[model samples]
Target: MKKTILITGAGTGIGKDAAFALALRGHRVLATTQTEAQSDVLRIEATNRNVVLEIFKLDITLEADREAIAAYPIDVLLNNAGMGESGSLAEVDMQRVRQIFEVNLFATLALTQVALRGMIAREKGTVLFVSSIAGRVPMPFLMPYSMSKFALSAAGAGLRAEMDQLKKNIQIALIEPGAIHTGFNQAMTNSKYQWMNASSYFAHQAEAMKKKERATFKFLEARSTQGIVNQIVKAAEASRPKLRYVSPWIQGFGIRLARIFGV
Candidate 1:
């Protein structure tokens, strides 16, 4: 079945890869980026790759940009646009934490509500939230990002049950991607250094923390986005998608074990 899917953060990383993959699978993909420059680049890349994608600029946090979603009768809304910040929660700036929540949670839910209006009228649609494995566990410096995803994951599950109770054909699913070798993870992990200084707590351990993060990624991060992309495609195409789709099965398994053993 050919469906129209709207994906946020389609300018790079997993989102970009998923957009191209879906388009190649014969679905109409509306790939939106945060800036016009990114949209232009994506357009060119899509052309070069011979993939048909409707590339556009859509900053999810902006009201006007979110309003644009109503213009298209979308079959699926993939909330993949997110930002990250890292620091000890005790010392981190509160504004940074708020900003992450504004993008990762509030704006995402707002857009979901906008899309839901149309989906409810049509009596059918799907919503996928791209959460993180960090959401499942406590990440020391990555708490800000992890907190947002945790809230998002919880909201996604709750919404799914609500929609079921309403008897609407709308489906809600979560896409939990583990550390993929996309620059995203590195950038997020390095974010804390921007604010940390000689006076800050844990300043002395900075180098050690950086080394550990790098080593962890080297050994645990998946080298390709294909694992998560495959899960996204499956959820998008399935008539009754699972409540959650986790990629790089091994990482998901590890998380489950950690939770079971109280790690």
Candidate 2:
């Protein structure tokens, strides 16, 4: 039962790994990236692997990108493209806050809306959202990213309810991985945080941020991505997948603890 799947942010990290894994499993995959270089890389990789993969240029934040994706008759939509911002809540720039929501929340939600119509019409489609553990638990100094994932979790939960109400066979799954061996942590560290570096008051805080980032990267690199990919593929194919699929035992446990502790 091969399905036609479309994954956003397919250039790197979990998205790239998921796209390749799905394609290798015989799914007709449309792997999208924000730049031509990423698209080219995925195309070349898929070609070398002899996997059926189509590359698309999609920034997710653009209306044109959403319109282009609408042309594809996809059986599964993987919303994996998102950005992260790091700063203290009070120190976070207002413009940066908007930028975070613009892509992670607004754009992702808009694309979901676009895909929902098609799924509803077909009455048999899966939507997998790549949320994060931050959404479930409050992490320090990552408010911008956490807030977006929180919103995404809320949206996914609401949509799951809507599907139930309409009696639609469509399934929505959230892949909330804690820390996998993806460049995600590195990306978060590399993202815009110069404000902290430049601020005299926040300079010490910035050093602490770097230390935490290093520790995170070290821990993530030790974890295998196969587990997360397995969960995602299972969710995509399961006849009755759970409302939210958390990845890795530790992460899933942490989320459970968060719920119990009222985080």
Instruction: Name the top lDDT candidate.
Output: 1
Q: What digit string (tens of lDDT, one per residue) describes model 2 on residues 164-253?
A: 788778888888887876767677665646666665456766677678788877865536778888888898878767888777777678
Query: lDDT value for candidate 1?
Result: 0.95
Name the candidate that leads on TM-score. Answer: 1
TM-score of each: 0.99, 0.93
> Which residue pairs show backbone clashes in model 2?
none
The alpha-carbon RMSD values of the candidates against the true structure, listed in the order shown, are 0.7, 1.7
lDDT (10s digit) by residue, model 1, range 39-149 = 999999999999999999999999999999999999999999998899999899999999999999999999999999999999999999999888888788899999999
Candidate 2 global Cα RMSD: 1.7
Per-residue lDDT for 175 in model 1? 99
